[model samples]
Target: MALPTLHYLSHFEPSGYGLSAIAMVRALRNAGYPVRWTPLKRVGYDQVAVMSWPQALTEASHWLRDDESLSDLPALAVVAAVVPLAGAAGFTIAHVAPELLAAVFATAAAESAHFERVAYTTWESDALPVHWLRCFDLCHRLVVPSRFNQAVFAGDLRRPVQVVPHVRRHRTNEFSAPDLVELRSTLDIAPDEFIFYSINQFEPRKNYRALIAAFVQAFSSADKVVLVIKTGSIGWADGPFFEPVQVRQHLQQMLLRMRREIKSDLPKICLIDAANLGGRRMDALHAMGDCYVSLTHGEGFGMGACEAACAGNPVLMTGWGGQLDFLGGDYPGNLPYTLEAAPVWPPERPSFWPSQRWAACSIDGAVQAMQGVVASPDEFRRLALERAESIHMQLSEPSVAAAWATVFAAS
Candidate 1:
């Protein structure tokens, strides 16, 4: 029984979509599927943002560059394009916002003939826009990350909507003694100070403003605590890549404003906005954290939080959205939130519309969650360790591969 070669099309950049595509391809290969990858040109960028793939994946298949033709592809090869679809004719998974689906369908349709399209997408809201009903008609099947997303999409489309979560790539290593010392020195922190780390784009829906405010309120300058935010910016022209200097400047201004509002000395905040951070460095960053925090309004699939959990950090997240799929109801770190109208930022091209509702975290709840972690770090770490193994097994490469195989089989 020969496995069909997967003619996968996706971005190779460091953005969420790019990372998810890379993980999906690796999972498929790990499950013994043959793959012939096509690296898609990132929207609004001239050259491919990240030229390198994981070395193990490079060994798995010779990835197709933009100039390279896949005319030689085997007849039986299945196509799975990460969305925007690039006019690919088979399964299309999306990392783009659901609001952009109409445009994606329009562009893809204009470029190529209609082909069997199994579209994988996710949404953060409870309801979709009325116009999306028609756009979804173009896709053969819809796959989402959680039951939350499933219900949202299923309500609008009269098609099968399946839940296939984003894969959780395990963090590479545990903390070595040298690693700990170096991490402390690099960040200029004390050995015993607790670190609450979060990785997210500096976007409105991410709710960074609230998180920063909560952190300041939760712990004072004298507390042995630090908040490390690894962030980037998503530009209209350049897609989801980061500009470290620009992001740093923006964050610094934000911090200054926040400091003035508080009218008090603030706890140390370490901001990391690097785009070229390597895997080992990322693993170290994850390891440095005593707890992973996400005060996000919502997520289609909370990749950063999941990655942090995999790194054995006790996660303190807004108790809503796709993250609940893996974190579960019993997870101790879930922060309470209110169902508020989802915000529409930038106004011109909003990712979410006014009618939709998403979770809004209570600042009090966030502060309390942080306080709990600070009061009993070891206890939380124990719970996190217990949770980590199950999470690692549950969303590992093999697990996600199996899920993908089921979706492909049905399609």
Candidate 2:
């Protein structure tokens, strides 16, 4: 039988989406689906293009309006305005921006006959707009990664959405204890000290500052615990994508400020640039860490958290987004921790920052959790191994491939 041809579209390059897109494409391909990854250029920032169709149009309109050549003229403005309408006509559409609802409605009306099945993945409550409801009305299905996401969509937008847990690419080999030791030695991490690692891009949304603050507060007195942060540099306006220079500078400043605020010497914090770690080195680093920590303010899917868990490291993350879906409901597994149930809003949104409405464990809380694990190293190791085994079974590549097969067949 011929393999089904599935097209995956995005605006940003593949690497930017981190591992979620990587897992999806890998799974689909392994399932005998011929995957076509199309990175759209005729749009604004690539992030929008990766989203559902309506988002792409909305972004494109904003991009055009921002350009001096297109904004002033009435005719050009009208032409620029029609792009989302064209997109709605050609593809499955979901509106993520409230301002673009009218455009989405017009586009949906124009393209109602073209698409067999239109879908939207509501990663959060903010993702659902009134126009998204209109699109949902026209669409055959709505895709969501978690029950929480689906519930928000249903309650807020009053739309029925299907849940498909975020798929992950499986690791090839389990790291041996000896391998872990060697990796620790290579990184110059102490043999006896417990290591907590976090790998993420240096984005404000990642909440790295809070993680650093928490680490300083929690582990500064205990020289036996090391916090190894592996992150690339943050991007600057009109700067190269994924540049590490700016991020390195920022970290230096933050560390200095943190030292002053905490009134303590700098703790053992190692910042690793992803560019410095090749495949073997990356594997070794993952193997070396005793635990993986991610206190992201928000995430569509916590790929790093899942990857860490898969690598036989216990994951310490905020209860948000798809992380909850991966960890299951009864998470932390009776560990001395209180998991908070809350949604993290984007910092860009109004009344988001400084609002303690989200269920993020405070730095003190995370420190307490980390301290419990550190004090009982053997217990932590046992839990880590168990979590790794569970992840291996639950997110096995073959299982994900099977799920993709079903999705493709339906598509």
**Each model's TM-score, in the order given?**
0.80, 0.68
Error of 1 at 194 (Å): 0.4
Question: What number of backbone clashes does candidate 1 have, counting pairs of residues 3 or more apart or in separate chains?
Answer: 0
Candidate 2 CA-lDDT value:
0.56
lDDT of 1 by residue, 183-243 (tens): 7888898998889999887766788878998999998899999998887643211113322
Off by over 4 Å in 1: 1-5, 44-115, 129-131, 170-175, 233-246
Q: Against the true structure, whose lDDT is highest?
A: 1
What is candidate 2's lDDT per residue for 1-411, written digit by digit as tens? 665444343232224342344455556555665444432332331123234334434544533333332232233223323333222323333323323323333444443435434343544323443334564554565666566776766776665555555565444334678877777777778798788888887754566777888788777755788888887655321111323447777788778988888788866888787766544455567667788887765555566777777776777777656666667656672222233333323323332323222344467767777777777777767777787777677676677666545543464
* Candidate 1, residue 4: how far the Cα is off, in Å: 4.4
Using alpha carbons, what is the TM-score of model 2? 0.68
Candidate 1 all-Cα RMSD: 7.0
